[model samples]
Target: MTVIDFTAFIGRLATASGETILPFFRTSLSVDNKSSNDFDPVTEADRAAEAVMRRLIKSNFPQHGIVGEEFGNEREDADYVWVLDPIDGTKSFIAGFPIWGTLIALLHKGTPVFGMMHQPYIGERFSGDNGSAHYSGPSGERRLSVRRCASVKEATVFTTSPLLMNPDDRARFGRIENAARLSRYGGDCYSYCMLAAGHLDLVVETELKPYDIAGLIPIITGAGGVVTTWDGKPAQSGGRIIAAGDPRVHEAAMKLLNA
Candidate 1:
């Protein structure tokens, strides 16, 4: 089947995952630390949501592969793969912030062809297929687009947190933050989605997994923006990503990031 054929199915996945995760939001859910040296938090909600989506995918299309944050990969060599980050902003989620969202991406032979960021608490879903993007929720549905921003000095940038970055990377990112008209922390996947929606300018992040970024590439590119590594490679594999509404801004950020 063509990639377009998967649109409705993606909606179903988002809905199912959203339903599975909503009840745990802002609740006294138990969290587990996935990292011994750092605070990499994972909750039952993350696992449960991913489990629900994985089951649906396996039942509906047994031939497909799956890669998830909570659960490991399965049949990852298959032509079609689904990359999932059930709660892209688990830290924000546990802190009772609505910035968290469910990230789902479909890759065709390792290329992202479809992506969605579903924030159930806010009743919003941002979806894309490289060619175009759309937003649907309480505010109603509309096509998504990125606003023009030509320079870092004129741009608003976001990162989940500079603290998440190591010392060298943090110093590098400080250059952009210093030049940007505005810089804010704590967005996670929502920052990328907002960049896609024309509400923001650039999003710079580091140390992201495939599941963290695979689902966001299409949405940003589809909305007429650009997403890439700091050195200008494709971002699907996820590391030191810089996304901007304007290519000029992207170039500027890349130079700063690499300088």
Candidate 2:
């Protein structure tokens, strides 16, 4: 199938997953810990949404593989793979926050070519292909592009938390944070969407799994932003990430991160 065909399917995929997720949004649903500690949470919403999306992919394109946070991997050697993070921000979701969203991405031969982030409660969807990006919400449809900033000191920076990084990385992050004029913490995947919308300048995150960032790369880059590993390489594998809406911001931030 052509990209247009897959794009149409992606729209439906997000809608279907959103339908399964909305009901559990603000409910007193039980949350189970997926990590060894009680902090990392997983709700039925995460699993149910992933299941619905997985079912759709398997039914429509059984040849494609799937890498999901909840269900694990299947048919990974296939040329096309669907990456799903049903609730990209479960911590915020369980807190009754609207910033949480579902993430979906398609990788062609292991290279991401399409991505979408959908927040059902907020009625927002951010989508992009390799060439362009767009936003859909109550305000209606619009194109997305990042704003230009000459330097990191003039930019607004964001990170989920310095705590997400190891102690050494945290100290390295502090150097960059100190350089930025403003630093806001804690938005998870939504922070990247905000950066693409020209509402923020930079986002640095660490120790993320592939599922945490697979859907965000396209949205940012298609909007004229740049995303890379802290060492100034592709972030496709999703470990240490630094994304900037402006290239200059990226250049300045990377210096501090790599220093």
Best by TM-score: 1
RMSD score of candidate 2 (Å): 0.9
Off by over 4 Å in 1: none
Residue-wise C-alpha lDDT for candidate 2, range 116-174, written one tens digit per residue: 99999989999988589999999999999999998988989999989878999999889
What TM-score fits each model?
Answer: 0.99, 0.98
Screening candidate 1 with a backbone cut-off below 3 angstroms (N, C-alpha, C), the clashing residue pairs are none
Off by over 4 Å in 2: none
Which pairs, if any, clash in model 2? none
Best by lDDT: 1
Residue lDDT tens for model 1, 1-259: 8998999999999999999999899899999999989999999999999999999999999999999998899999999999999999999999999999999999999999999999998999999999999999998999999999989999999999999899999999999999999999989999999999998999999999999999999999999999998889999999888999999999999889888
Instruction: Tell me how candidate 1 scores on lDDT.
Output: 0.94
Q: Over all chains combined, what TM-score does candidate 1 have? A: 0.99
